[model samples]
Target: MTEHRPHSATTAMGNRHDYLPAAGRDALLPTYDLLTRTLGVPRVHQRLIDQADLRDDHKILEVGCGTGNLTIMARRSRPAAEVTGADPDPRALSRAERKAHGLPGIRFDRAYGQELPYGDGEFDRALSSLMLHHLDDDVKAPMAAEILRVLRPGGRLHLVDVGGPMTPADGPAARLTLRGHHVAGNLGDNIPRLLREAGFDCTEVATQRHRAMGRVTYYRATRPD
Candidate 1:
């Protein structure tokens, strides 16, 4: 169930600078790992799996599967499930493939969120963990559309990212911090809105706080059957 494929150029529309620069991203892998560990990434991913009810034949897709940490978790928790990890960074995908060696039902692809390389209605579930904050402002809706396009009717979508509903008092402060990071910061309850606009029905929007990443939202949505 594992396959490796080449990527195209246009797929990287907005996320051409996932972490500022390509070299910086490759160099920060270890640091990012450390940060995740300190921020209780395992518990976060476990919550993600708990939110998803995987079946014997569920085919799972992990968007922005950096180093495949969440991807590995999903595969291990549901060994029978078919799991495919997609990312635009070949360096990250390379590490993901290396980490998933000998693991059946887990694969990696060099693709972007706005341009997934799969057929329509090919997956039962799709998950994005702590990666949406890296996307550029304009790519949000397009990425959601691609997710919806590749999912079958009634397929589920799960997203975990840094940002959520903001209060009137939070408007200015949030926008300032977001501008500094070159990320939209979502400053609003944006993920669910984007998914809803892309034809998915959002069922839940939960929040958690991290010492370093601030407020993070967990979105659970489903395609209309």
Candidate 2:
């Protein structure tokens, strides 16, 4: 079994603004796409996409789509599926929209993960990548519930985020990198339990370690049919 580690931190009470400065934000827009494409980190997202067994007719929703990298990938992977990417950052949404321009059947919206602006059971699959760590339990727990709420009865939720290695001591820098984000520094520990509490059965938990900086953890859960 994978070891779980929890860290303590103060949760943000209300909607928080992006920490990146304007210039930094602008720079990140293009850099994000380049890095994800070059390093194949987005493959983590791809794994989730593949696990969902997304069909051309499936309606998919991506929460916290950084810059449409995964959104575009999903659209291309499932040409017949209607894909929508939502983010709380307006700048990120703009970048996503620009990246997706001229792409039919794909759209981007400005929204929060904790409070998605969509109807219940509206999508066949709901996904999030590298976004949950930015949220606290106050946000993440509810966000998981919201993801389950928006997914169809038999739909699945795929989450990709930073987590510990097979053991906490296996990777030290991962904890530091997460601390740098000032979000859920070490919250991956609660994911499974949280999913259970949110009314979903976590079907799988997979992990991939990066040199020393961090490891990626992916969770696939399903709403009861």
Candidate 3:
């Protein structure tokens, strides 16, 4: 998640929507990076990038790039690839741009997931991490559709996020705090269903208990040629 500004920006489709701040509040935005890192987000990001299998000539997009931690990692991992990060929050985009400074073939854009400014079939792969849960259930489907629309034939969407209910394997504190009231019903099953409905062949690649996020899952969604 990224920090929100007082003003709103219109999407390419002329739709205006408010964005959730990085930490769910403007006051906590500064701690978003630290909190995500503590929750092992960096490791998950690396796994997502590896799953994307970036090629040197590939053009990739990172939705909800926030502070750009994952975006920077992907860019560095494949320096020859073109990396574009899209987020609605200007503050977060600023942080991302600064962090990604001097990195060739990488840029940050101020845009929302459901209304990306890019042309159709502009990207080879799209990456998202811990972003879907922040979206309202209704928005998730359209967001998936938009991602599918932006990806070229045979392109893939790499994602990792809260999947379903927590278990004893997750820390007791996490089980208590990560109840996920805002999480969609049957998230583990629903995400793939949404992607498939959006015309991608989707699969749950992995699942694990996180120290802070409860049960998390990884997905690989490919757009058919």
Global lDDT of each model? 0.74, 0.71, 0.80
Q: List the residue pairs that clash in candidate 1.
A: none
RMSD of each: 4.5, 6.9, 5.0
CA displacement after TM-score superposition, residue 101 of candidate 3 (Å)? 1.1
Please estimate how well model 3 matches the true structure, expressed as its whole-model Cα lDDT.
0.80
Overlapping backbone residue pairs in candidate 2 total 0
| Candidate 1 lDDT by residue in tens digits, 122-212 | 9999999877765666676778888998899999998877677533334554445455453355656567777888999985557765555
Better structure of 2 and 3 per TM-score: 3
TM-score (all chains, Cα) for each model: 0.83, 0.81, 0.88
Candidate 3 local lDDT, residue 16? 38
lDDT of each residue in 1-225, candidate 3, tens digit only: 323332333232232347775566556668988998888888999888888899889999999898899988998998799999988877778888888888899999887788788889999999999888777666777788899999999999998888654455567745664564655543548788888999999988888777667677888999999
* Candidate order by decreasing lDDT: 3, 1, 2
Candidate 1: Cα lDDT at 34:
69
Candidate 1 ranges beyond 4 A from true positions: 1-24, 166-185
Task: Name the lDDT of candidate 1.
Answer: 0.74
